[model samples]
Target: MLAQTIVNGLLLGGVYGIATIGFSVVWGVMGIINLAHGAYIMVGAYIAFALNQWFGLDPFLAMPFAMVALFVIGYALQAFLLNPVMHTSLLLTLVVTFGIDLFLIDLFVLFFSSDVRAVHTAYSGSSLEIGPVLISWVRLVAAILSVLVAIASYLFLNRTRTGQAILATALDREAARLMGIYPDRAYGLTAGLAAAVAGAAGCLASTIFPISPTLGISFLGAVFVVTVLGGIGSVAGVIIAGFAYALVQAFAATYLGANYQQIVAFSMFLLILIVRPQGLFGKPFYGES
Candidate 1:
């Protein structure tokens, strides 16, 4: 039972890790607490759904389209809307994002309705048995894809010129600007990349969980806890923390109850904040002390 639970947690954590990477990137790079991050996830899921419904595209195959769509949306939002207030107080930025989040939630509800949906594939119900452990095929694929996404993201950030510029901007915007890196363009690119990652996560999620207009809220909460726990901006740290959190929740749900799972997770989040505000792998950002 313990082994099975561990495996389940690992699978779930992989997906969670992918979902939170975009959130971490946006926060780490732009110092923007994007309350609309979850909205992007929701939009991605919907895109996959629409593609599947209309053209019979596999969720995995439709992910790229979702990514492209969200990337454009994110770039535009940052360039036109968020950039104007980029120099404003953090509180104002937070409020603006919050308003945008609310608007997205309402928009999703109006268009998609509150109905719950899931992507059904031929292998969704299949499972693989190894010794005493059973793993769902759909979840296994999602987990593998999640890890690949993380690796790809890491490579992109380290190898590509644009990615290097992004890293430079994240480290010090003024220094990056001195090096001829346009902070505005980098910021927009960062936002777009984050949205692309979120879209991938949402595509994976559609295969595993039922999605709804309000599902983004729950995902947003989870992302917050994971981002803080893993330390903002640390991709490897996020992956490790994701697995740790999933294990904890899985064990809590198994031993206590479903209701206690979130309670325990949130409690741990609070304790971590009180004890080590820097998080497991977090370093102080530009303004942070």
Candidate 2:
């Protein structure tokens, strides 16, 4: 049972890690905490469901369409609204993002209702047994996709010129500008990439879990907690933290009451904050001492 729980957590964590990577990329590159990030995920899920229902496309194949569509939406939002607020105070940005979240939630609820929906494909119920581990094929697929996306993102950030520009912007906005990187365009691109990642995760998550407009709130917390525990600027740290959080939650649910699972899981977040305030991998914020 313990081993099974661990596997469940690992699978869940893999999906959460994808969401965290998106969150971290935006934060690390664009300095935006983007409270509306989960809404984008929700939108992507809906898009996949819609395509599968209407056009008979497989959720996996429909994911790229959802990703591209969300990317455009994210790009436009950043280009217009967020770009104008680039020089504004952080508090103001936070307020704006929260407002965006509220709007999206209401919009989705109005359009789709609050009913839970899932993309129930034929393979959704199948599982593979590898020795002691009983792995759901859907979970395995999601994990594989998550790792692929994360590794692709890592390579893009490390190898590509535009990717390096985004990294430089994250490192130092003023320095990036001095080095000929256009800050506004870079931020828009960062936002788009974040949305794309979110979309892909959403596609996978919808297959594993039911979706509702309010689902984003729960996912928002999970992804942010994972991101905070992992560290803001470290991709590898996010991956490790994802698995750690998953294991922690799975253990709590298995040994303790399910009701206390959240309490135990977030306690780790608090513990990490107290012990390593700079995050597990990233350096401390400027002017800490």
Candidate No. with top lDDT: 1
The pairs that clash in candidate 2 are none
Q: Name the TM-score of candidate 2.
A: 0.95
**Could you give candidate 2's per-residue lDDT for residues 51-145 as a string of tens digits?**
88888788878779988998998899889888888677644666777888899889999989988888888898989997888999999988888
Point out the worst 10-residue segment of candidate 2 by lDDT.
280-289
lDDT of each: 0.87, 0.83
Which candidate's TM-score is highest?
Answer: 1
What is the TM-score of each predicted model, taking all chains together?
Answer: 0.97, 0.95
**Tens digit per residue, CA lDDT, model 1, 137-247:** 989989999899898988898899999999899998899999999999999998999899999988988888898987778898889888888888878878888888888
Instruction: Please estimate how well model 2 matches the true structure, expressed as its whole-model Cα lDDT.
Output: 0.83
Runs with alpha carbons beyond 4 Å of true place in candidate 1: 286-289
- Model 1 — which ten-residue stretch has the worst lDDT? 280-289
Question: lDDT at 159 for candidate 2?
Answer: 91
